[model samples]
Target: MSISPEKVFEVAALGLGGNIGDPPAAMAEALRQLDRRDDCRVAAVSKLYSTPPWGKTDQADFFNCCALVETSLEPEALLDVCLSIERGMKRVRLERWGPRTIDIDVLTYGTREQKTEKLEVPHPRMTERGFVMKPLADIAPDLPVKGRKVRDWLEEADIGGIKVAGDQDWWRAR
Candidate 1:
């Protein structure tokens, strides 16, 4: 079967979450910004979830979700786009696992395995974070990560305080 060039975009998954400000709104805006990019398109977005803060338990709960994007940009460039959007949304990095206005992580990129100072595909810590795994499973249950499907990792993740906050179209709201 001849593959069409138009069907060659790489599919990437992004994990988005935030605990400060209007997190849901910030996340929605971030998704809109990505979809506005000429080289990227938001393919699918999972339901919004309210999850307990990990690592730093001093902060408020976080709103989290995952999105599948079809893009022509390379993995690094896509990560750059995500970072740019976070900056645009005023994300402040005070400390590792600290609260922020918005945070976006490139979870996977077209089945690639990459490690760099600035980015990592199939995010190294994804399997251990229920906040990321649960939402990711909603959109791409069978997606492979570290030789395991997202659903599989989710089965082993600690999802104690996670609860659905909105439907699949949650990102459509302001």
Candidate 2:
């Protein structure tokens, strides 16, 4: 079987979440910004989900989702893009796992495993965070990021109080 060059694109999964400001709108803007990039294409998005704050409990509940994209950019470069989007949204870091305007994490890239000062693929604690796993399972259930499929991990994750929200996509309400 001859592989067509047209079929080549690295799949990157990004986990988006926020508790401050208009999160859905922020996330939508991030998605649009990502799709607008030349190095990437937003291929799939999970339905938005509501989940209680993970490490920081006093903040408002977070709106979360996962974006699946096909990109030519390498892992760290993709991470730079995600951070740029977060900074554009005015993310503040007053504390570790603190509440923020937005958080865009590079969950994984094409089964890669890496750790560096700038980024970590497979997102270190992703499998332990139900807020990350649930929506991820929604869009790419069969993705083998680690040894297990996203859906399989979701079955074991307890990210807590995660519920689907309606009427939103890459173009969410303003």
Candidate 3:
């Protein structure tokens, strides 16, 4: 369904990562594509960071960042947008938590919680991933996820190898 450009939508957050094939460029392209959509708006983006691989630690470290978005699309539709962006970036699903051209995980959609086979809101692993929280704090430090603030979670998470890759606004720096 085509969304009218004039429509408004609930605020949402997304986690983006890409460690292969010009990862930063991949993320920038994805951001540009999302903003080009009439259904979504790229509200805010965090600076870029390089974090030690999460889950599967056998490959390249991921370039991680988070985005604050405004969207007229619902959770499932928004997820479709993310997956479309990944596919556009030449992402192939060969392994879970494996290296990819791009990875976009739906972190939260208006405080909703879901456990469907298609998607999950407040991304099941958001709180546990410092790569997600650190950049998230850059945009919305006080932003709450499942009743807990990003800053608070960051303080509690073991963010050992997450490094600051750049100080510029990665989402709009293209």
Badly placed stretches (over 4 Å) of model 2 are 1-8, 167-174
Off by over 4 Å in 1: 1-7
Model 1: per-residue Cα lDDT over 1-174, one tens digit each: 997776358999999999988999999999999999889999999999999999999989999999999999999999999999999888888899999999999999989999999888889999999999999999999999999898999999999999999999988966
Prediction 2 global C-alpha lDDT: 0.87
Whole-model Cα lDDT per candidate?
0.94, 0.87, 0.88
The total number of steric clashes, by the backbone 3 Å criterion, in model 2 comes to 0
RMSD of each: 3.1, 3.6, 3.0
Measured on C-alpha atoms, candidate 3 has an lDDT of 0.88
| Order by TM-score, highest first | 1, 3, 2
Ordered by lDDT, highest first, the candidates read 1, 3, 2
TM match of model 1 to true structure = 0.95
Could you estimate the TM-score for every candidate? Answer: 0.95, 0.91, 0.93
Predicted candidate 2 versus true structure: per-residue lDDT over 45-100, tens digit per residue: 88898899998788899999998999999999888898899888888778988888
RMSD from true fold, candidate 1: 3.1
Worst 10 residues of 3 by lDDT: 165-174
